[model samples]
Target: MGKSIFISLPVTDLKVSVAFYEALGFRNNPRFTDETAACMVWSEAISFMLLTHDKWRSFTTRPIPPSTSSEVMLALSCDSREAVDAMSQAAAAHGGTVDINPVEDHGFMYTRDLADPDGHDLAAMWMDVSPMPARS
Candidate 1:
């Protein structure tokens, strides 16, 4: 079987988190979803398991860090710079907070960052792989 990656995150509210992700165009995989968790599939190989705090705690001894005080960030890639902007805008419309840093235009890459309702830092980025001058 092909290898797969599932990023499991502890969410304070399952329904709210699910709705936020859905607004970002992700689909829920019912096969792995339940009252305590929701499987959000970003792609065939990349999935996110939004587990309730209690269910998440069961898998670890460390305390679940409050989202507002956490430092972890999750970055997701898009197909183009426009897409990065679009997703970030969608996040803001869905109650997510956009970081103060202005959108970055690196010529070959573009990026914007946002924080979800749970205060999880999420970044939307795009890389232009077309031929370009090498950086000094």
Candidate 2:
């Protein structure tokens, strides 16, 4: 298995994207963050590479999709419902838009989705482990 997962995303404005992720409580990993790209670490095993449009283009010859036409959504899990709400609120305060309605509290789980400054779909979710059925 891989040691970690690095999800690379193209951002129209690197600075704005950095701020957007920061608002969601992600810390910048200096080891991988610089002028060309900002590394947003969600966990020890998960990291998001926010690449400038030009820098991202270098990885592929195909044209990048416009933010409006893209439909990719990145879902991240939180420890509790309050964390989910906190992330959504932070996103809005940092200029990111709430793309979905507030937490759909299903008792065992809660979910909310938001769009970053560059229109990247991001979802914050919380799950109650105690309520889940036991695995056989």
What number of clashing residue pairs does each candidate have, in the order they appear? 0, 0
lDDT of 1 by residue, 1-136 (tens): 4899999888889998998888777899999999999999998788889999999988998987776675767788998888888888888888778864577888888889888878888888888877676889
lDDT of 2: 0.86
- Summarize candidate 2's per-residue lDDT along 1-136 as a digit string, tens digits: 5699999888888888898898898999999888999999999899999999889989987777766655677889998888888998999998788756465778888889888877778888998888777998
Model 1 clash pairs?
A: none
Best by lDDT: 2
Task: Find the 10 residues in a row with the least total lDDT in model 2.
Answer: 96-105
The TM-score between candidate 2 and the true structure equals 0.90
Model 2 / residue 46 / CA error / Å:
0.3
Candidate 2 versus truth, CA RMSD in Å, comes to 1.8
After TM-score superposition, the amount by which residue 26's alpha carbon in candidate 1 deviates from its true location, in angstroms, is 1.3
- Check candidate 2 and list the clashing pairs: none
